[model samples]
Target: MAEEKSRDCCVRHKKREPDQYRDMINRLSRIEGQVRGIKRMVENDAYCPDILVQSAAVTAAMKSFNKVLLEDHIRTCVVEDIKADKEGTVDELVRVILKLMK
Candidate 1:
């Protein structure tokens, strides 16, 4: 078998206002930094409680990120889908909520 070459892709499908885009990206970047900090704490033998606290922080940050994104999706996608008579989006959102709860 020949070597499987990897290809790079630039798929820019999601369109958001500049401010919204910046806000979401900035939130994710902060969460990424928090995750890296947790990795460093683990590598350096940080206290278990301290690490747990930091882990909780990361989890909170992720939850906040999800909340923001979900709000945006509901505000734009869900609302637009409803307006456009695409009722499936509501069902899709219910599935998403169930998945999130689990």
Candidate 2:
């Protein structure tokens, strides 16, 4: 049942501003590159500590990305939904926040 609900939500979409979209895509691209660098480091037999540092950096970058996206969602999607009388959006946002926390 939970999976079905999640799937239902997946069918909905939001149109983001062009600048916001571009910024998110750019951040993801950088994170992707960082991940690839880390992979190369492993394949090249780099020192454990050095590879760990790069891994930590990628984790931090992903967290930063999530923060920006969450802020934008609250500022736009959540606000819009609430204004439209969609109280369920609050519950959805809470669920998402909890998931992110984990």
Q: Against the true structure, what is each candidate's TM-score?
A: 0.83, 0.88
Model 1 alpha-carbon miss at residue 86, Å: 1.4
Best by TM-score: 2
lDDT of 2 at 20: 84
Deviation in angstroms for 68 in model 2? Answer: 0.4
* Model 1: residues with Cα > 4 Å off, grouped in runs: 1-12
Q: lDDT of each model, Cα atoms only?
A: 0.85, 0.94
Steric collisions counted per model = 0, 0
Pick by lDDT: which candidate is best? 2
* Model 2 ranges with Cα > 4 A deviation: 1-10
